[model samples]
Target: MGILALQGAFIEHTKMLHRLGVDSFEIRQKKDLLLPMDGIILPGGESTTMFKLLNDLDMTTTIKELIQNGLPTFGTCAGMLLLAKTVDNYHSDFLGTMNIAVKKNAYGRQLGSFRTTGTFASTQNVPFVFIRAPHVTEYGDTVEVLSIVNDKIVAVREHNQLATAFHPELTTDTSIHQYFIDMCQQ
Candidate 1:
């Protein structure tokens, strides 16, 4: 597995994957993309900055092609924003491969951040850490809604792509990551 280490809580993800006995590497520069990867994880962080870095490092097109070509990908928080096809009023899409519309910081800014337990896929009591998280406003029919909080969409899966507005890596629960790993195994 390859985790984008350009920005955000990437270290936490690495630790989590390690605890799960999953060997993972970080994609820090363009050359790192050349390495073989069964899946990719876009960790939570500043979406705009990560996007700019992806472009500045000349890795945008290559990463997009990998994902578009059926790479199993898991995105969390700001990572979700990067994968979204539309981000409400924001112009330009990052990967824009996933057919979903999201509202960035929908739960308000950092001051509005909070924690909660909710259903995520077949798992119950999944702890979710939301820090300026985005919520899905719209999605294509091919997208499967995985979890919702207070009527707002928080998780969804579409083919090889899996996205969540919450930071699962921030908690002890490994259900979300395990789900992504299962996806990679398939």
Candidate 2:
């Protein structure tokens, strides 16, 4: 497994994966991507900063290739923004793998960060932490909305890719991380 360490909450995701007994490492540069990665997690942070780093590190092409070739990927918050097909205000498309349009920081600023318990798809009582998170404004037919809060789409799954607007790694629940792991195993 690999976590994009250019920015954001990569450490939190790494810790969650460790607790699940899954050996994972950080992908800090293009060289790091040389290591075999079955799955990758894009953590939450500033989308514009992540975008700049992806290009600065010259990793946009290879990372997109990996995901396009069916690497199971889980993105949270800014991760979600990067994978989105279209962003309302952002001019560039980071990955644009999923066919979803999102509004960056639709939940407001850092002060808007909050916790809520919502069902993840058919499951119940999953904890979510939203901090300047983006929500799906619209999705294509193939995209399945997994969770919604305040009537806004927060989580979605498309084939080998899974994305969440909230920071699932910030919470104690491991189901979402486990769910991504299972996807990788398949």
Question: Backbone clash tally for model 1?
Answer: 0
Off by over 4 Å in 2: none
Model 1 spans > 4 angstroms off: none
Counting clashing residue pairs in each candidate, in order, gives 0, 0
Q: Which tens-of-lDDT digit does each residue in 77-141 have in candidate 1?
A: 99999999999968876889899999999998899999999999989999999999999999999
Tens digits of per-residue lDDT for model 2, 141-171: 9999999999999999999999999998999
TM values, all candidates? 0.99, 0.98
RMSD of 2: 0.8
Give residue 78's error in model 1 in angstroms: 0.7
Q: Which lDDT values do the candidates have, in the order given?
A: 0.95, 0.93
